[model samples]
Target: MSRHFYSCPLRWSDMDAFGHVNNAVFISYLEEARIDFMFRLAPGDGSPSFSGGSVVARHEIDYKRPLVHRHEPVTIESWVTKINAASLTIAYEIKDEGQVYVRASTVVVPYDLAAGRPRRITEEERMYLLKYLDDDATGTNKSAEDAEDKDALAA
Candidate 1:
């Protein structure tokens, strides 16, 4: 599976007194990338696609390093880690200059606006998400084992 990458610009206000991007701000970056990916994959034209918006059920983030303000945009790579009957998990990495600053995942459920409840993923939606399934455990880029090996050697 190929990962979708989004280049997100950093704002000066994203920095905190500690001289690095605030931890909470990382959520915004992830949200932006997810939104962009969703819109691109399923436009708002009310097509048979997954046009129904989704709601985030959970978010988990691991901060690997602090991100300092820089002129270049931060790159967020995202891919579908798992897809279920009603929800899907998206894994993400925020990186710059080949260094990962954050690793995160979000659980999102398809929402029915008028019904004010969650709905099962449609067949079309499931098929669309299948194209992004990253079953290798290593993700869309490197393998998890390779990353662990590198970390172990570095330590």
Candidate 2:
């Protein structure tokens, strides 16, 4: 399967005393990338989007390597990892120069803004997500070679 990438520049303030990006910063970057991906599946032309509401029930990350401040771009690749009746698990890979720096996953629950609780996945959203659904018959997150530390980044 092909991966989808969203590029973002490293901010000067993202660095820490070690001169490398802080561990927590990677999770934030992943959030931005995931939002962009979800927004693309939203209905309407940016006005009445279908992005009603979603709560992050779980989030976890692992720092495989440190990234230094650089002018070169950082690429965040994300895709659907798994889905259940009311939750969706998304996996993200943050890399530089084709080498991985961090891999993460976020468990999100769709909420019906009016109903005020988790809701079932809509057909449109499911179809969009299914496009990138991981198909590992073993039922483990280690479904891809690049995702060896998959469960380590799960909450």
Candidate 3:
């Protein structure tokens, strides 16, 4: 499966008084990357756009380390972790060459803006997401080698 990479620029204002990015600001960064992935890159061939409306049902974040403000941008690697009939989960990692600063996931539900309620994922949306679906069967989020080793042990 392929991953979507978004290079998010760090702003001086994004840092808190502690010289590290504010925890809350990380949410905004995730939103920016999600927008880029779902709207900017989502198919425009008459498919319903997420720009119409979508809500964050949940967010799970693990801050691995502090990220200080820098001139260079940090890359956020994103991929679809789970997709249900009415919602989908997008996973991410905010990282540089050396280490990851954050690992997170957001569960998003499509909304019918005019109807004012959540809607089921359309066939088009499902098909589009399938392209980026993870190949891992266990869904354990482990490295490929680790997963394989586990499978061998289980067998």
Candidate 4:
């Protein structure tokens, strides 16, 4: 499966007193990439796309290195890791110039706004997500899945 890539610009305000991007801001970059991948491609307007709605069920992140403010945009590579009946996981890497700053994944549950509840993945949405599924993720997807399962058990 091919990964979707988004070029994310870093804002000066994203930096902290330590001269690096704030830890919390990295999640925003992940979000930008995810929306480009999962929502923007297909229109929602009563279509079988995520723009209709989805919610983040959980997040897992590992900060690998620090990133400072820069003119060049960082590349965020995103792809689907897992697909459950009512949810799907998307993994990401915020990196540039051979250096990785953050690795993360978000579990997203498709939402039925009219029904006011989570909904199952439709055949169309599933097919769309399957295009981004990476079955050879070097064990990272397993770790993400394990973390989600552990969190579920706890909840």
Candidate 5:
């Protein structure tokens, strides 16, 4: 599995009074990288690919260093850590230059747009996502099967 890296510019408004990028801005960068990765794997109709509305279940961020206002370009890299029928976890490492400045993980759960519930991910999507999954990730595809099986049993 290989990670997808996206290059995004640090907006002028992204800075704060401290002369560094705001904390919330980092999540925005993560969102952009995640969206870019998903678009690469699955091109949708200009909406999120996850079935159910793809709500964020968890977000954890660790800032190793601060990004100043003068950085040239920032690179945000993301890859699947685990994929499940109802939820998917993507890990991100955001950097400027060759040094890592932030490490984060987001757990996004699938939601049924029509049924208004968590939905099981399709096998095609699961397969498409595997190409972008992290090599160090353990049991990425296998976790998805359990959610799928549970959904099957429920139905």
Candidate 6:
């Protein structure tokens, strides 16, 4: 199993009155990461690939810590958690200096633009997704304690 990592820059505009990143901005971070992964997996060359695009069926997010604006980029790690006939779940973690700030998942259904309906994932798409399959039984790549320890060491 592998993880797709995207380095997202934190903007001053992302912060709210409380001085932490606004909750709504977290979704945009996840979206940017997902888009990067999808583009890497399937370049939009008009081929019958997952790059055709997908619709978000569901989103689940757990904010572990409030992220303050920083010059350093935050890292978003994404991987496939499950793949069904027409949908797949993508798990993500937003981390800075190895400390996780948010954990999330998004269920997306492959969509057909021409037909205006959801469609099954092709074999090629399935195999590509399997490359990033989350094999950990706990469903998380790293424990909170582990992340904290790594962050401490990095500092």
- Model 4 clash pairs? none
Off by over 4 Å in 6: 44-46, 141-155
Considering lDDT, which of the candidate structures 2 and 5 is the better prediction for this target? 2
Residue-wise C-alpha lDDT for candidate 6, range 28-100, written one tens digit per residue: 9999999898777576665568766689999999887889998999999999999899999999989977568
Q: Among these predicted structures, which one has the highest TM-score?
A: 6
Error of 3 at 123 (Å): 0.6
Q: How many clashing residue pairs appear in each of the predictions shown?
A: 0, 0, 0, 0, 2, 0
Two-way lDDT contest, 2 vs 6, winner: 6
lDDT of 2: 0.78
Q: Over the stretch 1-155, how does candidate 1's per-residue lDDT look in tens digits?
A: 77889999999999999999999999999999998876675766556455666899999998877899988999999999888899999999999786788889999899988788999998877777777789775454557635844784596
What is the Cα-based lDDT of residue 27 in candidate 6? 97
Question: lDDT by residue for model 3 over 1-155, one digit each (tens)?
Answer: 87889999999999998999999999999999998888853556655667569999999887777899999999998888788999998988899995677888889999999999999988878887777777772323668535544654586
lDDT of 4 by residue, 39-146 (tens): 755674557677668999999997777799999999999988899999999988888887767889899999999898999998888998888888784425667656
Ranking of all candidate structures by their TM-score, best first = 6, 1, 3, 4, 2, 5
TM-score of candidate 3 versus the correct structure, residues matched by position: 0.86
Clashing residue pairs, backbone N/CA/C < 3 A, model 2: none
lDDT of 1 at 19: 100
Model 4 misses residue 58 by how many Å? 0.5
**Residue lDDT tens for model 2, 45-154:** 65333388888899878677779999877999888888887888888878877677887888988888999988888877878788877675122255564464554356
- Tally clashing residue pairs in candidate 1: 0
Q: Model 2 misses residue 81 by how many Å?
A: 1.2
Give lDDT per model, in order. 0.84, 0.78, 0.84, 0.84, 0.76, 0.87
Among residues 3 or more apart in sequence or in different chains, the pairs in candidate 5 whose N, CA or C atoms overlap within 3 Å are 52-111, 52-112
Model 5 global lDDT (CA atoms, 0 to 1): 0.76
Q: Each model's TM-score?
A: 0.87, 0.83, 0.86, 0.85, 0.79, 0.87
